[model samples]
Target chain A: MDAATPQLRVKRLRAVLQSVRPFSSPKIELEQYHTAADLAARILLLAQSHGDVAGRTVVDLGCGTAMLAIAARACGAGVVIGVDTDADALADAASNLRALEMEDGVDLVHSEVGSFCRSVAKRPRPAGVHTVITNPPFGTRTAGADVAFLEAAAALQPQVIYSLHKTSTRAFLLGRAEEMGYHAEAVAEMAFPLPKAYAFHRKSEGSVAVDLLRLTREPPAAATAAAAAAAGE
Target chain B: MRLVTQNLLTCQVKACMDTAATPDGGFLSYPLKVVPDAGGLKQVASPFDEGVAKSILPRLDWAALRKTAAELGVAALPEEVPAGAESDAGFLRSVYALVFDIHLEEGNLLCPHCGRAYPVRKGVPNMLLRDDEM
Candidate 1:
């Protein structure tokens, strides 16, 4: 019961989230492949190690059932917001938060990734989010969905972002992040397990090489000016 | 929505940002008012960590939280987080309740400036703006 350490909390979170069901819809081009609880915990742990999650505000884009969001909260994030367009996923996330007795720390928002990002961007700088940890669509079904999530997340200019993407897109993603004024680094690579959930998945379980990217925003001119002002220039 | 989130939320409508600027040229949302439905208030217990709460205290809009808390009939929150509140058990419990326990299951979060209403249904606030507003 004493989840005092980050490692212990991650283990507890994995067990709690494993029971939540993934939301699926054949209509959407992006298939709803749930991120394994262990993987989610690992990502949270990486973010925590980098001083991103603990006592910071975190936003999870395309948060299906809020696996990552819950993990972020368990890792000591002050507030975790999980944004998803799927009503079913949001409902499941709500239930899971209740189940974990974490309704207070985690919030589930029903909105598209772009809308949520823009809304957060519209807030004043002080209210701006600190970090974004998302496991977005791999773009297997939708050619550009993953990029869309990246674009929106970059717009918020969070201090740090931890994103999961297909390893094949590493080069393109790095280039894209550089152009968007962010430094992207592939911090970890793992075999992402794909459980057979849809009829199209021939294998009962498959694995794909995926990369966990840590992105830090390049300081904007305004930020530079503010920093100077703070230093009493 | 709890005061924890309400403290962070503001009118996302573009025009509301300008109104947030004070006469002294400082930026602060003039404490967004809430129309809470008492029937929809639900208390869901969550773990309370004093350290985490203390760490987040500096980032909170105390004025906004006080106003919102008063509106919700939980006026115990002080106008300012008292000195050494980190070790204050009563303060921590009150903050814990305001932040994590008090859930607004249904209501409208009205922007004091733009007058736009973000509806809360089933504990989720719909922050989507109108097309023209965006």
Candidate 2:
């Protein structure tokens, strides 16, 4: 028999795979798209490292199976929404949320990223919404896909935006964000393990570099002041 | 131990770099999003090595990264490989620094062949393809 993987999450994952009954047959088809332990730690890091997640409106772009959003809720985000284009994934996401007993803490959206971003940008965040988090795709190359996403994220100029991508992608990300008018900062990053017999990842994942970022928009003192004055009336 | 660093070290896909394009660069596919199994989460990727980054630096499509880098307001790197620094570990460190240290908080990885853009939100890259692209 193959030697057992020693990683804690790996061992834990193997157990889950063998035990968890499927909602209606396992959604194994979407297994390749779920978030693993390492990334979960990263999301936790983003929540804890930043002080508090309480009362923040989090829009999880490309939410895949809503794992991150659920984690965000557990970490104390006031509200969370999982957005994706896969209908089945959305259904699975809803089921997952129900399983976590966090269905009330989360919402699901079935839509494309760009259209979603566009719609959200057109309106102010409901009541207390504030942050947007995503793990966008970094196609075969490192920089191209991320550069475009960063540009779009900056357009809305949210106070904070967190994105995960390959290590081979920082220069373009930072440089592009600057050109687009937001100050980009690499806040916290951690490596996640990649197991074999999976899609997208082919190697025995050990420590491939993945980066996390915190992006802040430029100051709008003048606009803020005007808006405040108008509100005072 | 950035997840981004972990990926470039082990992504050994043959012909992985952007070939025939003016510049060549390796793909960094780690930092993936996975779902929680009853035991652990799925979709997470492996980490990379500092050593492989050095070996791969010279081969990176500098022209392409530079072009993309410039759009982000970074200084333009020379189109061709500069002399005297090919074998320098520091230079490779510079390459690793660029590839792994920066973050694309709100962006998408666009498909070079199809022009399809994948969204990157909250430090995660959504590299999913539409039914047609797949």
The residue pairs found clashing in candidate 1 are none
lDDT, candidate 1, A22-115, per-residue tens: 6644234656788887788667776766678887888898888788888888777878888877777778788888888877678777666786
Best by DockQ: 1
DockQ of the two-chain complex in candidate 1: 0.30
TM-score of each: 0.80, 0.49
Where's the lowest-lDDT run of ten residues in candidate 2 chain A? A224-233
TM-score of 1: 0.80
The iRMS of the candidates, in order, is: 3.0, 18.6
The alpha-carbon deviation from the true structure for residue A141 of candidate 2, after best TM-score superposition, in angstroms, is 7.3
Please provide, for model 1 over B30-113, each residue's C-alpha lDDT reduced to its tens digit, 9 standing for 90 to 100.
455768776878887776777667766776767777878777776656767799987887777678667778878888888877
**Model 2, residue A153: displacement in angstroms?**
3.0
TM-score of chain A of each: 0.85, 0.71
C-alpha RMSD of each candidate structure in angstroms: 7.2, 22.2
lDDT of each: 0.75, 0.49
Candidate 2 lDDT tens digits, B1-134 = 12221121111112322221232332332112222223221122223334445444543445445645555443456676667665666665565555544544444444343344445443334434445432
Error of 1 at B26 (Å): 6.5
